[model samples]
Target: MRFPSLVSGEFVKRINRFVCVVRIKDKEHFAYLRNTGRLSELLKEGTCVYLKEKDKGKYSYELLLAEGEKGILVCLDSQIAPKLYAEGLPAGELVYEPKVVGGKLDLLVGKELIEVKSVNLVRDGIALFPDAPTQRGSRHIDLLIKAYPKYTPKMVFVIQREDAYAFSPNREMDPIFANKLKVFKSLGHRVVAYNCKVSLEEIKLKEEVEVLWR
Candidate 1:
């Protein structure tokens, strides 16, 4: 994703509550804004960080991290994921629209009108998505199935982090999603789990990664 006013400088301090204040000059202060792609460890109290400054916030906008600094966007999936489809195999006919029969979708991949879920919770080489309960996640499966009776639309839980070989639903936290995913498999629709190699630079959709299914 492209961000405006990318700040390539050093980290000064995390001022206020969420603002990561940086020094571009003597009187210039650059605060790290909260955005989607920004990670926790990337912004240290005294670490060199690249950011994008936006004027859309009263106090701050967000900092878009450059992946090249850490090379997190290199693989996207399968740096730790199992093996499903190949990476960079060409997103042929993979439509990018949001339309579900019973509900709404996130994006479309060809005949697969799918929903994309981004998980940020990671621990010891494992990352789980939907840190909280998602009634919508459980419902997406039903909607996808209804959208394509001939072929079940795929619902991909895209884990957007690093150092994981597989992906799993947060059954303990959201058993509804887990149970629905387990039940949905009988319909012959695809439930894909993939990991994203993220950085301050870019977040890519990778192929040739591994997946775990019930």
Candidate 2:
């Protein structure tokens, strides 16, 4: 997905889960953080970030990406994953924010329930999810497990970087979620993981990566 009016800024600090203060054009402004992850490894003081201006919104700008260690750009917007999928994937009746067994999933493509996850953490060519502990992620897996018989349940992990050779659940961060993912596979549910080729011009889903779990 291409960001039309994005501007470069320096990240100041995260005020809360949904908001962050950014220094744009030598002026400090609050921007909406589209990703809710802790992002302890990515977001830092003075880090270069991308922002998009909003004429009428809670914040003047919205946070898009941040420069991590080794000069790698990480896309912080989780919402873009599904948007990219919806734009690139095959023609299917997509129902957004569909309610599943006990929780809401990202989309319902045809007869399948799909949950989209944005991955930011990549180490040694391995992409991992839930940089922090995620009870909500675990709960979604549980709900998908319950919905497996009636509908095809799928979990899609979008690695928002180019360095990933494989994708896996972050067992070190959230063992509960990792265990539930194993149960999800054992129950015959599907897991799709793909890496994106992100650049200043556009961010596009490129190719599927192997899903590794133990």
Candidate 3:
């Protein structure tokens, strides 16, 4: 998806999960961070980042993109996955945040219940998800598992960078979530991962990558 006009900045420090300090043109400013993941790999001191100015808020700018290894632009907005997924479908074929089976799923394309996850951490050409422990993500998998054959369950991992050639669950960070994914796949559910072509102007869904579940 296309982004608003972005300003280049240098990441200074993270004040909290939702706020970070960035230097734009030698002036430090507090920016809103939409992703709660522990982005230790990307958000380092003096790292180059892109931000969108906010009209009226506690923070003047919102963090949108960050430069990863080898100058790859990684999307930091976690909420963009469903929007990117919806963009690939025909009009009226995709539903956003639909309530199903007692819980809300990311998107519903026909009978398919899709749960989209944003991934930013890439190591050794492999993208891993849930940079931190995510009980909420595990719960989403459980909801998909519960839906079962009644509704086709799909777990889509969107790697918001172009460097990753494969995707895998961070088993060391959240084994429960990894195990739940295994169970879901064992039940004949679908698990897919796709890498994106991210730039300062926009981020688009690229080709599907190998899902390395081990």
**Which candidate has the highest TM-score of all?**
3
Residue-by-residue lDDT tens digits, candidate 1, 1-214? 3224455555666665456666554434656444332344444555555555566766443444423233442222212221122233346655444555655666565555666666555545555655667787778777876786644477666565555666777677778888888777777777776666455555544432355543
- TM per model? 0.62, 0.94, 0.98
lDDT of 2 by residue, 1-214 (tens): 7777689999999999999999988999999998888898788899999887788978889888888777877888988888877776565688888987878888888778888899999888899998989988988887777887788899999999888989999998899999899888887788989998887778998899999886
> What overall lDDT goes with each candidate model?
0.54, 0.86, 0.93
- Once fitted onto the true fold, the runs of candidate 2 whose alpha carbons sit more than 4 angstroms away are none
Q: Write the per-residue lDDT of candidate 3 for residues 1-214, one digit (tens) a residue.
A: 8899999999999999999999999999999999999999899999999999999988889999999888999999999998898788775778889898899989988888899999999999999988999999999999998887788999999999999999999999999999999988888899999999998899999999999988
Q: Which whole-number lDDT from 0 to 100 does residue 93 have in model 3?
A: 77
Which scores higher on lDDT, 1 or 3?
3
- Clash tally, candidates in order: 21, 0, 0
What's the distance in Å from true for residue 54, model 3? 1.2
User: How does model 2 fare in lDDT?
Assistant: 0.86
TM-score of candidate 1 against the unseen true structure: 0.62
Provide the global lDDT of candidate 3 against the true structure: 0.93
Error of 3 at 59 (Å): 1.5
Taking all chains together, the TM-score of candidate 3 against the true structure is 0.98
Whole-structure CA lDDT of model 1: 0.54
